[model samples]
Target: MQAVITFRQFSFRYKNQSEPTLKNIHLEIARGEKIWIAGPSGSGKSTLAHCINGLIPFSYGGEMSGQLLLDGQDASGMTIFERSRRIGTILQNPDAQFVGQTVGEDVAFQLENEAAPYDVMKTAVSSALELVGMQAYEAQGPHELSGGQKQQVALAGVLSTQADILLFDEPLANLDPASGAKAMRLIDEIHRNQGKTVILIEHRVEDVLLEHIDRVVVMNEGEIAAIGTPDELLAAGILPRYGLRQPLYLEALSHAGLPLSGFTDLSHPESLKPTEDGSEPQGPPILSESQLRDRLEAWSTSVLPAGRGSLGEPLLELRGVSFAYEPGMNAVADVTLTVRSGETVALLGSNGAGKSTLSGLITGLHKPGSGEICLRGEVINGWSIRRRGEEIGYVMQHPHHMLTQHMVRDEIRIGLVARGVPEPEREQRTEEALQICGLYPYRNWPVSALSFGQKKRLSIAAILALQPKLMILDEPTAGQDYRHYTEFMEFINRLSGEGMAFLFITHDMHLALEYADRAAVMSEGRVIAEDAVARILADGGITSRANLRETSLARFARAQGLVSPSRFVEAFIAAEKKVKRA
Candidate 1:
């Protein structure tokens, strides 16, 4: 196999940075191989990707050392345009990467830059859209697409260039499972059919590229930690130590107290089956109806209707809300919804369905010309932007948009100071927030130095410092992997228990199914239906209207004829316990 990307004792230090982000790293990626880079956040995974694509030393001013070769050429001497012609890079934020209004134009933007012929560019754009399964959306505006669709458009743009090596930085971030599966399939197809070299920088280790990955490369604190086959790495227990999840099937088996002797390969999906036909089942269901009901009741207790006789007071309400940036166009229309105290409601919808527009209206960032907004049982149509922030803390889909401070500690403290909190209490609260967000160690670190995941956590901490009654979080777990996702949600659950109401705007159906007390489906700028999570998901009308797909677990359960999907989580946990005992 020919080496496509090679880093020999490479080290890099950003401008004014005392320490190197990447230190004496040595790595080699062979041509036509699909590799997964997995590790804790701030582990130089993204830096490694940037180094390969000529962004590190060229675009980013940094002190560089050692040698880096891309396709047998020294990366140190290559211009960005020259490097880009050989490598296709899809960044973490697809929206930031998009350069054109329409999908077709965006895909063709790269080719046009290279001065490709009109016919050639057109054919490349068409083929790229087809490759990403977004051929039907070519005419749609980039802003009109959902988070997942935006990512796919960005991917199509990269593919249109026909670069031999594809570099993806958290490509699955903000995508729903179905779209994620599609993207993964496309990557696999590129590797198998096109024989392209691929490097995937991601945190999610379960199920995305497990079957297609040829090898695993783990990085920690700017250095390579370990590199090997998934089996070799998991058997050595290296993944969990760095907060990365092993394959769910493997983790589930371990949690279920199952013996590993019967399973030769933990990575194999078939390894999860019962080893013996007559083996005893796990102790009991993890979530009984009574338990689930109790949890639901507890959640609803704080926000239940104010009185049986009178319509409940709407903390925030929208009626006949319709909005679009231009005249004669509508992104959201006739949308009516309400959020009350102590309620955690999930906004569910497919790409381009206007959920984000609804969020902007509720937050007062965008006004609904056709409808009224009532806050605290009174119409707040006249409230200023500053006044809305006092009552509601809105966290955008991208944390960078909200972050304004140079240090994490300062970022958290700014909100407290603005809210008139006493200096002593503010300090105490800031410390507590940092501790909860697991950023205490990095309190004094520059905000720009933080990794994507850490920046997300810091954003949450900043919001927590304000202690707003209602928090609106958009795609809260967008780029997070299983471990971080679980940890972050656990924190949210704790806050919800403390009487904080949340309006969670998300595209992840699985997260909504697992965490939301009530699910509201949005379509064509309207709240088409609202019900319990299970009911909303099962309602064919709502599901179809929202363009929602069945969860991966649900699909797997149906394929295996399992009675309940929740049982799988419990069974897997039980298997893990059994394995630990053995």
Candidate 2:
């Protein structure tokens, strides 16, 4: 078989940097093979992906001392356009990759750039969209689509190029469980049907590309730590050593205290089955206060309530709130809600349902044109952004939009200083914030150098340093992996325990089911429904009202005939326990 990609003794140092981002790396990818490259943040996984696509020494200014061959040709001498014909790259940020207003235009942009004939481009674009299950969105504006839809469009655009090798950079990041599963399934189908060579860079490994991957390559600190089958890498126990989280199924098994012998060989289809005895020994409970806290904190800020109360005074209350950008535009309409002290409430809705706008009003980023916003039973209609920051910390949907500082440490300290914290005290608070966000190790690192997920954490860390009474996070886990999500939530739970309320906004139904206590569903800027998470999800009214699909886990549970909530939980726990024993 031809070697689709080959890297030998590859080392790359950025302009003016003393250390290389990728160091002494060696790798080989066979044609028609699907491989997953995984590691913790800042481990050079992205750099390696860039190397394979000829972006390192070609597009990016860097000192390259290595051999990179694409289709048996030296990659260093190829232009980006030349490389694109062989290796189509779907970037982590879908917005950054989009150049056309509509899905059809965007997918055809690349073909047109290559000067393909109109008929050829049209035919290729149609087929690519169909393959990715995005044919219905051909005329839809890319910006108007949901995050997941946009990602699918981006993938279709790449496929339209007819490249032999497809490179995915954290493609699942920011997607809800349902959308993530759909995207993964589409990729699997493409590889199986076309025998395409695929290179995936992602953190969620359990369900993504696991069954389809020919091999798994693990990177750590700018070098390859292990390269082998999924089973081989998992058994070696190198994941935790590199600050990466083990797969959830594996973790579940470990939590149940099951033996590793039964499930360590993940490649074997039989390994996923239950034991012959139909029962596994019970293990000690793995739940910890810290873990619980982390899980709760990780819930999107927009979902949380303003405070804890059985029926106490509302910290933030919206009475008959309604507004829109234009006269006929109704972003939010007749929204009436109250957030008490010490309660976590999640705002659940589809795209353009006014979740973000609702959050903006609560955070004082925008004022309601009608109705009243009350703080502790008092209206604060004209409060300044600074005053609102003192009471509520708002973390935006996009981390890049919120980031202004060049360094991670400085970003954290900026909030403290602005809050009138003394220089010495500000430094101490900044350090604490960094430690909480797991960015302490890279305190001095440039913000530009951080990954999409790390940048999200940094945005939260900066807001956390301010220590507001209510924190509103918009899509907090949008680009995060399972491990980071766990950690981030734990931190939030700790803060909630300290009497800080939160409002979480998100499109992730699984997240809402797992972490949220209270749920609020919105549609067309209206607070149509509100109830407990379980009740809201069970009703199916909210999903239909919001025009969203049921979460993947929920769908899978239903398919398996696990209707009862308790039964589903028991099965999940049992499956998790079974894996731990392997």
* Predictions: Cα RMSD each: 7.1, 7.3
Q: Assess the local accuracy of residue 405 in candidate 2 as a C-alpha lDDT between 0 and 100.
A: 93
The candidate that wins on lDDT is: 1
TM-score of each: 0.81, 0.81
* lDDT tens per residue, model 2, 362-392: 7777788899988888788788877877898
Off by over 4 Å in 2: 133-140, 206-211, 229-242, 246-250, 263-271, 275-313, 325-329, 367-370, 382-386, 481-488, 507-515, 521-564, 567-582
TM-score quality measure for candidate 1: 0.81
TM-score of 2: 0.81
* Lowest summed lDDT window (length 10), candidate 1: 302-311
